[model samples]
Target: MESMNIPMRDILQRILKRRKIRPRPGLNYNLEKQEEPGVSIDLDATLASMDTMEFSLVRENSTRRHHNEGSEDEVSTMADSLTSHQYKSYIVSMVHRLRANTDVQLGVSGEKVEVDPVGSKGTKFFKQRAMTYDADNIASCEVLEEKSTGKSVFRITYLISHDYKHSDFEADSEVCNEIVSKINNILELRLSPARKDYVATRAAKHLRKRDSLRDSFRLSKYTDN
Candidate 1:
């Protein structure tokens, strides 16, 4: 009976050995090969290359931005130059118009003075007055010739009142307003809207100078006391 039991145990052991599951020899080896250290390093290099490409793209975008800025500056400079040229042309045209106006007379003459007869022996007096015609309470406009070249230039000379003094309030007088209106009309006919503003500014400066001269003369007359 013991001998039969031992043989049966041996047969069971053989069946268990035949049916047991065993690990495949190459599975771990394949996994280790897939996860090798060098393979991970290669993936890192690929990521670095992608970063470099992105940096180059950003640099190119910055370059285009700088180029656009430079073009905009050039366009602004060209526009300024064109504006300056138009202003110069407008000035020349204004000068030509003033020169061609026939109403502006050209010359310079001395003031006339009347010498009174001697009173009571060796008592004589002289009265001097401007020979120019008076314009409506403002100033007389005259063109005087240059001494050297005979070229005529416009001059604004203030007129003395019948009360024997210069008028201090002529800056805003009707005559000045009429003169400014005439200048504005001439500029409007010859200049564009953009250039008219510049010419008007210059005309205002001239008028300011004339007004300043009038004020100075009035001050001098009073200070003599």
Candidate 2:
């Protein structure tokens, strides 16, 4: 029986060989043909183009950053300049108001005189005069007069230029108070003892109003900006 099975297997093998059946190829022919030299060159070119695009993007981003930084710095500088100008204008305006309220006299001749509010060196001349009262230079003294007799009683000099060095708002308040104190002292000394209490009560009101007006102006400016 085993000998009969071996002859049948030999017959089957010969029949299959005559029919010419073959095994499949290991590599895919279509894929191999598609990946030719031209395709590889195109892939390399695509990679190079991507690198160039990436470099361009990086450079553009860096340029934009630098431009933004420069613009920010310019804006900051402009804002600082505007603030400084506004502060100076406020100081000059205050000096003008002081001159308007009080009688101004030249220190040299002890004669009553009028000073120009617009062209006068506002704080600079005041500071100089406070440091050293010059005979030749224009050093003016402010005179506070009694309303009843129209008589010059209290003489308070302006030393506002000394406050230019103090940048803080509190320092400005202190300087204003110091000036007020000088005025009040002169009033107390010149007036009768009976009116001393009344004079002291009204001492801070005028200066306080001036400071309030200044603060309001600053607040409005900040809001507008």
Candidate 3:
């Protein structure tokens, strides 16, 4: 019913739950709760529960695709603005040439994203698809980084999901593993020191220029009792 970007989604859910906002007469939000995400992932449920908190930290060490449409979750043109992942996907699709390391990342909604050539990629907005109003579901994703001896050797991640009504973290672990595998194959085949600077630098720019990982509380409607 309510939505908006905020600090860590999980933390927000806990706050809402304790404050007696959840299962009550209201829009929606999240709190500071924890659970085992297991090995599986559900991109759809993850995205649908944008205002809720995380079920597990181990499973949630990933990225999301969202942005404020004037600080409100409901919008006439939800797709006009791009979430971070949506932006990432759009840019990749725009200038992507498969000859490069760019691989299309698909999630539960059957939506796709890609990475740009290891270069200075800007965090800009493009367009988005109309978000379906399914209070019971969401699509979520993560960017995976594999390290070797203190250096990232491989990196890849994507969103996963299941039916909106099903929020079970372990429900789609198998599908999540498969998504990870697809990304890893692409990264292992394309990642290299020569292009490392380009790829790493861009992501670093995003890290430095983007919002904090724990700032979801102040932003989402779920926490805005």
TM-score of 3: 0.18
* Model 1 vs. true fold: TM: 0.18
After superposing candidate 3 on the true structure, give the runs of residues whose Cα lies further than 4 Å from its correct spot: 1-171, 192-195, 198-225
Strongest candidate by lDDT = 3
lDDT of 2 at 84: 21
After best superposition, candidate 1 residue 140: deviation in angstroms?
24
Instruction: Give me the runs in candidate 1 sitting further than 4 Å from their true place.
Output: 1-190
Q: Model 1 residue 136 lDDT?
A: 27
The CA lDDT of each predicted structure is: 0.29, 0.29, 0.31
Model 2: ten consecutive residues of lowest lDDT: 52-61
Clash pairs of candidate 1? Answer: none
Q: Name the weakest run of 10 consecutive residues (lDDT summed) in model 3.
A: 162-171
lDDT of 3 by residue, 34-83 (tens): 22223333332433544433332221334332334542342221222113
lDDT, candidate 3, at 5: 35
Better of 2 and 3 by lDDT: 3
Which is the winner by TM-score between candidate 1 and candidate 3? Answer: 1
TM-score of each: 0.18, 0.17, 0.18
